[model samples]
Target chain A: MEDPLGKLMPSEVEFIAEDAPITITPNFQAGVFLFLKERVGPFKPQRPMEVPMWLAVSLRRRDKCVIHVPEWLSVDALTTKLEEEKMQQKQFVHMPAHFQEISSILFDVASQDVPNSEECRQLIQAIVDVRTAKIRQGGLDDMKDSLAIQLNNVTQMEITSIRQFACHAMDAFNRLSSV
Target chain B: MSYFDIDDILMQEERLPCVASIDVIKMGSLDPSSATPYLRKGSKVDLPLWLIKSYREKNGEDIFEVDPPKFLGPKYLDMLRADATVINLQSWCSHFFSFAITYLTLFQDGDLATTIQDSFGHRYLVILDISQNAVQDDTSEKTRNLDQLERQLFHAGLQDDRAQQQWRRRQAHRILPWAGAPRRDAFELGHLTKRPKLSFS
Candidate 1:
């Protein structure tokens, strides 16, 4: 099998026993956790950058975008807490998006107060525009991996903006990405 | 002397050496969907020495092949070493909690636990739950599967003596059962309820 990294084929085959397939429940709102099932195949041939497909949709619903972290439970009680949590709707305890999407959101939020903020906004919108095109070119089925990649790219772009926008959103972006 | 009681173990150098061994250590997300394949067949994995050393500054060796060892890997053993350094029990407790968070899992149902454990003793619990869908409320298979994963973590917390003691202590004072006696305490209370009849014996 070809190495997933694809840069330099590793000398050793290093065959890790393939793990069983993973199944997930989809969250319709987040524009991120739309995939109901996730399999760990070799990284896709050409990955998408980290711009979220649902950025437009999430932005439209930003007013409703709320961060609700569940209360911390006892050490031993975590499993129980998570199980109880699993029983309920998957709440967006962290910022209301995946790691990459959260970074982009923070980036946009920071730029909202910058010089030529409208221009910055357009730059971000352009990135989102490119992402939306990619999504449309490859239907939802083929877009999952690409979406993850684009989301990562958007996150990287946000990281670079930390110097430009020293805001809570930037602070959060740093923390979330580091985590 | 704070929240966790490691004084006795720390006092005994040989019994609880400066570095005791760890038999099993599993790490990663606790969500069943995220924890599935790793926990599949309840598989337990070894922690590399470099990673274990990242947690503690001490000379150590991989003892996975050694008989009569303390643990399956060094991470759990390092957790034991860290317990001795903390003065506060809450800190110690939290340390253990983090260990559980990163290493162990919670499996929910008794039957599923039995089924999975029966198939793979300690190795089956490593499955990862990567579910991207929203977790639901119904007692459907999805919920049951996820619950089983939680139950595995709960039990994993009980695998070690430190974790076991904390688990028991916490359960002794759990927040539930508003209007009734807890079963564990009830059993102990039942024995006390027979007071005054002890004179004959």
Candidate 2:
């Protein structure tokens, strides 16, 4: 009966990912602004400083700063990761727990700042496709007899996406086997 | 099961083949064909699972002998063993797994439970694959033959698959208007109070 709705909504996940750190260079001088949960920035002109993604997005919208795209979301880095994912077909490749949410949200808010943003989006989509296909195709073998499986390097986004189906399947399997 | 579980209530109504080993007194209404004042010895009748269990509980266990239903018998087991994936379990019984579970409780039958587990083990992945990939397609045809429990599992998988795809498409953030929400122009300040009568036509 618990988890009837089964995991957070994608928007809620994006909200959680907002707290993750990003680098931003402000165009205008502003003193430290204190938010409810965290304090951010004595922003100086032409100087790079660490800030949360939400703050960067807000600042970018106001023409106050430009976001510095993270290295992992770069096109070249993602291409390398995709190759590794394809090479190691049997195992999941490690990523940030909220990479999917972060990447998508960044693309939404800071596409101009991110170089080769479209190619990066496509590469990230391809990586997600490859991983999901692996799960759907071969990942079920280990679950045939056991309730638990080793989820090495699997991300929170991946886990949440499949949590509903996996939980229901395992519950049914458990009921049948127990009988 | 809780008092309000409809599935448990329905499963309890599944009739079992029961033979009265000894004369049963004042229970003749259960069998319309019996002419005796009380149920006579060696009378065969199909009784609901609840009645059979009640007899076993309220009275001694010797009054009735419950024969294993034909569906769980060797013949059906052989059919199931031959090819479980192709079997139309719904045609045999509505609540097949639940009924089997109840049967296992009343009579400790390891073989029955094993057969069930094996069939489910084979079919579960196929159902998962179908539900996961068949977005926008009519899956009722595919799920028509599944047992009740299996059908529920298929639906669960289907829902999750669709949810992930929807979130990926950025459609998860659209807030639908509530059913009874007030309209945007529902009550203007001017509309709430009496408007001054329009001067000059």
lDDT of each: 0.27, 0.78
Deviation (Å) of B56 in candidate 2: 4.7
Q: Which candidate is the best by lDDT?
A: 2
How far residue A63's Cα lies from its native spot in candidate 1, in Å, is 20
Candidate 1 lDDT at A143 equals 23
User: Candidate 1 has what TM-score?
Assistant: 0.15
C-alpha positional error of residue A46 in candidate 1 after TM-score superposition, expressed in Å: 43
- Chain A agreement with the truth for model 2, given as TM-score: 0.93
> Chain B alone: TM-score in each candidate?
0.14, 0.81
User: Model 2 compared with the native: what TM-score?
Assistant: 0.85
Winner by DockQ: 2
DockQ of each: 0.01, 0.25
TM-score of each: 0.15, 0.85
Alpha carbon RMSD to native, model 2:
7.6
| Model 1 per-residue lDDT tens digits across residues B118-156 | 222121122112121213423234323222223333222
For residue B148, model 2's alpha carbon misses the true position, in angstroms, by: 1.8
